[model samples]
Target: MLDARAHPSCISVAVSRAVGEAYAARNAAAQINCSETCFVLAFVPGDLDGRRVAAALEEALEGVPVFGCSSAGQITPHGYETDALLLLAFPKAHFRCSSILFEPLKPLSTTAIATAAQRHEKTFSHTAGWHRLGLIFADGLSKQEDVLISTLETVLDDLPLFGGSAGDALRFEDTYVLHQGRCYGNAATLLLLETDLPFRGFGFDHFLPGGTPIVITGADPDERKVFEINGAPAAQEYARLVGCAVADLSPQIFAENPLLIEYKDRHYVRAISDAGEDDALSFLAAIDDGLIMTLGQGQEIIRTLQSGLDIHDEQGRRPDFILGFDCVLRKLEIEQKQLGRAVSEVLCSAHVVGFNTYGEQHCGVHMNQTLVGVAFFGPDQRTLY
Candidate 1:
């Protein structure tokens, strides 16, 4: 049970297990006080009908703009959940937003996207005392995230952006983003938000680069598919590097032993999503030939996760709530290590409300096996609506 009174500074959060029906959305919507709500963000279970959920929310919310996508799983006030429909209502008293939807993400035109984003930013009325940030939700199966995020960052310039690729419960099929009352596939949405509360955007993963470097000998960057690694079949090479047989390759194995690529001064994981035909490998993020990467070594996941979420303001006050975009791979890793309950405890204490994703977007990069989020802190001595 989520008690809104427990966190006065936070926005309304409602969760419902009665899915695939209108009454369930109505029951959930009834829990949120929508008088001041500007928009409602929803995280629907991948097993449900997106169109049905979208229609229900639209009818129940009575015209409050709704936006979101199907997720691999949700993190509610109660922590990790798989079958619930989660909603977060952002009140107009504290937040304002404008959203843009891009369909047919394939054959994406960076030029067009950049132009539209720049124009959208300029046209949106900037609130006098509010800080600005961006959130994006794209079809997880869409291989366009790398290009999409990079273009947005380049055009938006200083505005911080964080998001996740929508997932279908690890089914790796048919994912959709919902806007208004419609569900769209091969699509994405960007929400430019202005908020009065102080906030911080961050991302982290629990892995370190260690071991001999493996070079990408052949790859299809556009498709994010690797054909060869170190002159051997991609999956075969990865299995050898991780000390596993080709037949033993699995999501858990990929999560446990990810490939790390060096960028600037830090390393980022380039997770393999699946082993494909002819020992080929499909990745979650962008990949190309001649890219040198190393096997990632595990760390104390719980410790790193706690440290990552334990953010404090100048006054040493914890955030009221965190909007998290955790990768599904991370969840897989935690479950594999039998740390689900422990990890859920950490998230519940941190007041995390969001969903697990196929990939995460932070700053200007698309990454895998990481958690990206924004933490919001209320103004001192002021009550949030």
Candidate 2:
């Protein structure tokens, strides 16, 4: 068990590897001061029972609102952790939050979502001088992020949003997001937060467009599956382009060589999740017929990651902490290159906390194979609320 208390900072983090939900919750709760917290965020291991963990946390915190979801893995104080339950406590002194839950994301009603979000934004009283931002946790397997994020962005204009799709490790099966002490699948939650601290939102990847542009000839946009690329079977063409047999294709290879799409003169990674039936390729982000993409060439992972997290303000002050949403595909590539320890050291040095995600959301777009986060810096001049 690792417990970290950030004195003079408003956020407290606790991590526990205890066997059962009760023990884990108790162990984590003992490290935080519930009285000082407005709410708690819990990242439960995908392998653990989220319902039991919810119950245990409810009992442990005694009514402090808890919201979060299952994760592929966790970023604790000690770095990447797989089997631990992690909790982040946001103190009432520095932060205030209001959350909205959207269920049945499959039959996603865009108009309804927009109206509800607009209403929530209008009704939630905002502080005069505090910084406001949005955080979303959605069911990763629902395949609904592309539309959901776009809708929220339209309605909640000017409010910066950064979020992650809830993951169930590598199972690629069921995933859940917790709200009001219950775990809900096929659902999403949005937390609108106001904080007095200075902060910045960022997203970065180590890839650049390298190969000839390939067109997606046939695809199922709703399912995020590509049946054909460059007029050939998706998987077969991908393998040929990468100089490997179809059978030699795997997650590691896909991570090493990803697809990049150019939008607004900027390139973004479109990661592959799996090679499926009938030579189809499954993507982590949205896909469509006639969309153009190119193979991405990677740079030094450690250097790029370090440069990405080496953020500082004009005053030369680093962030007190960062809430990060890192793609699991990136994690796979890092492990394949034997850079886990080095990456973890960088994460620890930067004070990053959060989880590995199936997909990441930033700048009004759903992306993959990228790290998106918000870094919170301590207030230079303290002011009374």
Candidate 3:
């Protein structure tokens, strides 16, 4: 277990399962002494016991607005972890957070989301010289993130949105978002934060395109599936290029190698979810016919990740805290390459507070295998490591 208090307004803790849930929640909240706390918790398959965690945290937080979600893996100040609970506390002195729970997200309308954003902004726009950003946690299984994020963008209007889809430890059965103390599946929780700090929102992946280029010829945009690449079966062609048989296509292969799509002269990763029995490929983000894709080659991950983090340092300010939504596939790539410690060191040095997500939301688009986050820089604070 690790506890870190970065500033008078922010603190973080990683609690192990060995500690009783109630004791851990109460003690961690008290130690941080913040009004807005986000907790990332471990999910036990078929347990569906969010009530236990919610009740305990609520008892400790004492009506302070608490929000979070289940995670595939939690990131703390120390490193990556499983079967642990991580909490990030943001005190009212430097930060103000307001959340709205959209229950039954399937039926979520754009107007309702916009109204929520407007309402939240009106309530808290009294503060000045503070940066604003949105943090979102949605049910990963609901498949409604694309619409919800875009709708909220209309209201946020360049305020910048960054976050992730909540995961249930790879179970893929059900995932939930937490608001206050209740767990809601098929729901989304949106938090609008006003921080008295110089903030920058960023998204990046550590992969570069290679010479291999493929084009989507047949697809189901709604389902995010591509059946043909360059008029050939997606699985077969992808496997051929990656030096594997179609039958051997797996998530691990997709993680080690990704497909890239060019947007405005830069390439963004389009990760594969899995290969289908029909030789189709499902992507984490939406894909449509006529989109050209190029195979990507990964860089030295540790160096690439550090370079990404170093961007803030190059800008004459380093982040005091970074609320990151890291893709689970990236985490898989780190484990496959045995670079966990190095990557964790970078995240720890950057003071990242977040969890591994099934998919990440950046700006207004839902993308795969990307680390999207908001870096908070205070005039009085600097990098710790």
Per-model tally of clashing residue pairs: 0, 0, 0
lDDT for each residue of candidate 2 in 79-153, tens digit (9 for 90 to 100)? 787898999999999899999999989989999899889999999898989988999999999999989998998
Q: Select the stronger candidate by TM-score from 1 and 3.
A: 1
The sequence of per-residue lDDT tens digits that candidate 1 reaches over residues 170-248 is 8998788987768899999999999888888899999998988899999999889999999999998889888889999
The residue ranges of model 1 lying beyond 4 angstroms of the native Cα positions read 3-8, 380-385
lDDT order, best first, reads 2, 1, 3
TM-score of 1: 0.97
Cα-based TM-score, every candidate: 0.97, 0.96, 0.87
Once all C-alphas are superposed, what RMSD does model 3 give against the true structure?
A: 3.6
Alpha-carbon lDDT, every model: 0.89, 0.89, 0.74
- lDDT score at residue 375, model 2, on the 0-100 scale: 87
The TM-score measured for candidate 2 stands at: 0.96
Residue 215 displacement (Å), model 1: 0.2
Residue 9 CA error for candidate 2 (Å)? Answer: 2.7
Model 3 C-alpha lDDT per residue in residues 97-124, reported as the tens digit of each score: 7778888887667787788778877786
Off by over 4 Å in 3: 1-9, 19-30, 34-48, 311-317, 379-385
